[model samples]
Target: MQKAQRLLDLAALLLRAAEPVSWREIQEQFPEDYGGSEEAAIRKFERDKAELLELGIPVRWLQGDEDLPAGYLIDKDDFYLPDLKLPPEDLALLYLSGSAALAGGDFPYARDLAHALEKLSFAARGPGASEAAGQAARTLSAGDGPGRGEVPSMLEELSRAIAAQKRVHLVYAGAERSETTERDVDPYGLYQAGGAWFLCGHCHLRGAVRTFHLARIRSLEVNRAQPRSRDFQVPPDFSVADLATREAWEYAVHPPERARVRLDGPVSAEDRASFGPRAELREEPGGATVELTVTNGEALLRHVLALGDRAELLAPVRLRRRAGTILSELARRVR
Candidate 1:
């Protein structure tokens, strides 16, 4: 069984235990698995405890209190999920929605939602928690979709830090400067915009909320030794969408200005979507012109370059000339 499934089983057994159950009893119940030679069982149990703690599940060992022998169980009060009062029908609908999203790979919070659904399934199915848990896991892990090929290690780490309300230090490469700098960030949330993932957080270095592209984050380490309590609190009204409004060239830290680009053919859905709603399109004799408010000159130039002969930079005389000079240099080099 996967460790996740085994952990769920362990949680169930502990939650239902009327009193602290001894290690020997736990061994007897899970022989060939949790049950083993005395030393092996103890070590295995210790590892399991660490995993549960890491996931925010509280497991406590009660030292032979009263007349009872020392043993382990999840804190019943802490583990008790608030009654959501959703009937089986409601839960089934949620399960279907979650499963479809996972299969389609469009879900931004796939990992987080998958775990929540598993726990919810356990709560909703009651006596059938085992089957429901397994089903939920299978559904969410159906396939490796786009951007899911390598299992976004940094994204996972950031998600955990967000949940734990921990501060993190990031070794980030500046997009335009190509300089690496370390910054301490208090992550508020992770968001997916267009085709990329970004972390919205408070940057101590910048003294502001900044969006860091996941691809640009060279490394991250959570500041676990700060203190027992959380180092920062996301303002109650804070939202990731607030910081995610910038697009393409708009991400450049510069005064924004409008620029026009002419395309030789109809805009593709992919291109139109990437430009977002801020762009205005006007039809021309042979093609179309798109007006965009840009903050990053190079970003706009890069996009136009990617489109090759299909795109032309118009107006913003300076930017257009810059694009032309670069193109001319490329032509000479290739010749």
Candidate 2:
């Protein structure tokens, strides 16, 4: 029998057995695979056991007593996930998020995520649950982009390093520079923004925390020393949420300046909250004015431009003039 078939058969046997299965019973069931010299058979079984453990199926051994025989069995409770009992709406939201992550085929573990979504679909017991999930999947898949070559492997390696708390050495191409530089980083976490994956870590080269775009990582190596032990600890105060929520204008590119914008159209609560907590808002007739600190004036300009007539830059005379020049250039191009 193939190793995969043998493993599956063994798992099924153990899961359904009323009591722990004896070594003799296992040997009898898979004599072709388990039958050999005593040492060889035992080694084979040990290898299979390790593989099972790696697959998250723990095959536990039980000690024989006067009345009970020594054997092995898979604890059902340990193998099966508990019912989450999520409502249909929440399940739909989860399906949407998962589908979005997999849409472009860029995620390294897309197969694993697809399997998880299948399991999640099985758990949808409420009325219209499956329909909701299907709708969400359709919405996300419609916008799928071409696969990102090589980025998947880099992401996978960084994910493993992050989980193992191992530092990584990287050959990175800077966004603003032509030359590539080598750096050692202790990866804190990974996040996706603007459809690109980024690794947030402490860079020994810069002696500070920095974010590296996965596409720009030309090469990398995770520390191999002490394979079973962690090489570093993530700082307690470090939060991926803070980094994920930052807007383009918030990046530290230029000297910080207070900028104001007037919103003429009715703003949704969600839109208002998009401005960080540091923003101050004042309500006026027919609209509101918001003042917030910005470090990238061009980013702020683009944001206002995207909002069209609904938003207007109100302060920092230099940016206002720059916006006008950009608008004029855009008009000239269209004309």
Candidate 3:
């Protein structure tokens, strides 16, 4: 439950209590197993009390009462939880931050993400979580990311397309180029990127695969969806982590390889900035093998080539040839 909602429960407890409760009386309500410092308990009371008030709970201090400087209570009617009207920026920030966490492989933290996503998704679905989500969309422009408008807007369309089982012709632009492709997509789900938004869906054109980086889509159109002969789904082994890319580069690499390379001295902090966190590194017997999930004959090879003797491509015959060709070209240039 959200802190806001949980505070509602606590306020209800106080309102139903027979008498005005002192801070100590409130602290004793928790089970003995909920052990913590006296100060911590008091601080929790203080914070939750304020939050409850913000929720329109009429929790307040009892004034002019001897030995009850911090006594608190609420009338049953005055203690009701108030509706919240969150601005769009807050909603966007909340969702983006949550989605990014799940995208980073922190599954344990997904519930919090799920909860926030639920609030927004539910608000968009019907009247359960709050009217804030609906009001939020109209209130704020861009919250955290300069590109946040893409998510709330695209998500509305994406969800509709999913339910109708329709195809959305998307205009996508990236390092590849700008072009529109009509994708009969079964929008399986949407997940967070590094503070960005992505939609995972099976593309009819690809036959069987998931795609992402919905924000980069410059244009989108909905069309009547063709029915699937078989039930379509993302592979069980597939995960958001596997599809993570800042630039929307989902193109398959040439092939997998075990490339060994030696780092000269310590790796520069500046160089570390280039290889993303997903790029794992293992120290080999002699040097190190930066375990990379890269395609064969990609720019990574050129990177290894640029490293000179400092790096050696030690796996995949395809990378070997590409390295050899690059080195041979470098030799000719040296002449």
Candidate 4:
């Protein structure tokens, strides 16, 4: 039998044994693999045991009492993962995120990630787990889109660079300009936003911190000189959260204006938080009115439109007029 297969069978036999499996039993199970001289067979077993230990499976030897014989066995508790009693909503989000990463085709560890998600689903217990898993699976399949053109190998390289605090050179496509430029960046971290992967880093070309979309990175090369050493240190004050949590409307394209918006229905705390930190809320009978500084009028208008009839832009007459004009145009298109 092949060494890999023999090792697998050995592990299975030890795991399934109610009591410690004797060495004689293991040899009998794989006679061919253990049929050489006694010393040679023992040497082979030792090698297999070492390999299993490296794989995180310890083959423990039991010193039996008078009744039980001395043997080897695998503790199920040691081999198996503990049950993660995650709430249904949290589990669903994990499932969705994993599925999205796989679907995006940019994540390098696709096979390993799939196995992990399977294990996550299996380890999930408690009420509503099955329902949540099912819902998440359905949601992922329903929303599956055409595969993106981003390279998975590049993403893998970037991940390595981030972990090692290494610098990278990139041929990046500009969003506004129809051109690509060479950039030398010290990568800090990678984040997912709006179903896309972005790299947050210190750009040498811009002489500042910048975020680059993974898809927009035409090509990249990690600084390979002194590969074992770190290229730069991430600043103590810099945080990926500050950049990742920013909403589209928070990206200042125009001068800031105090925009008032009325939410005429039940507003979730999450919704309120999306209005940003500067937002002031005044609660009324049925709903609440919010006043916040807006910098991206187009993004704010789009956000209000997504909320359907529940949200209305009350102040900033210019933006209100633009929203009205967009609605009118949309109505015309539909008709």
Top candidate on TM-score is 2
TM-scores, one per candidate: 0.56, 0.69, 0.42, 0.58
CA lDDT, every model vs. true structure: 0.77, 0.82, 0.58, 0.81
Candidate 1 segments whose C-alpha is farther than 4 A from its true place: 1-111, 116-151, 172-181, 193-196, 215-219, 225-229, 236-238, 284-286
The TM-score ranking, best first, is: 2, 4, 1, 3
Ranked candidates, highest lDDT first: 2, 4, 1, 3
Question: What clash pairs does model 4 have?
Answer: none
Clash count per candidate: 0, 0, 2, 0
How many pairs of residues in model 3 come into backbone collision? 2
Model 2 error, position 32 (Å): 14
lDDT leader: 2
Say which prediction, candidate 3 or candidate 4, comes out ahead on lDDT: 4
Report model 4's TM-score to 2 decimal places: 0.58
* lDDT tens per residue, model 3, 276-323: 575667665655566565654466676676677767776566777878
The superposed Cα distance between candidate 4 and the true structure at residue 316, in angstroms, equals: 2.7
Q: What is the lDDT of residue 287 in candidate 1?
A: 80
User: CA shift at 265, candidate 2, in angstroms?
Assistant: 0.9
Which parts of model 4 have CA positions greater than 4 angstroms off?
A: 1-151, 254-256, 266-282, 306-308, 325-335
Error of 2 at 59 (Å): 6.1
Q: Candidate 3: where is the Cα deviation over 4 Å?
A: 1-179, 190-198, 212-216, 222-238, 245-255, 268-287, 291-295, 303-311, 316-321, 327-335
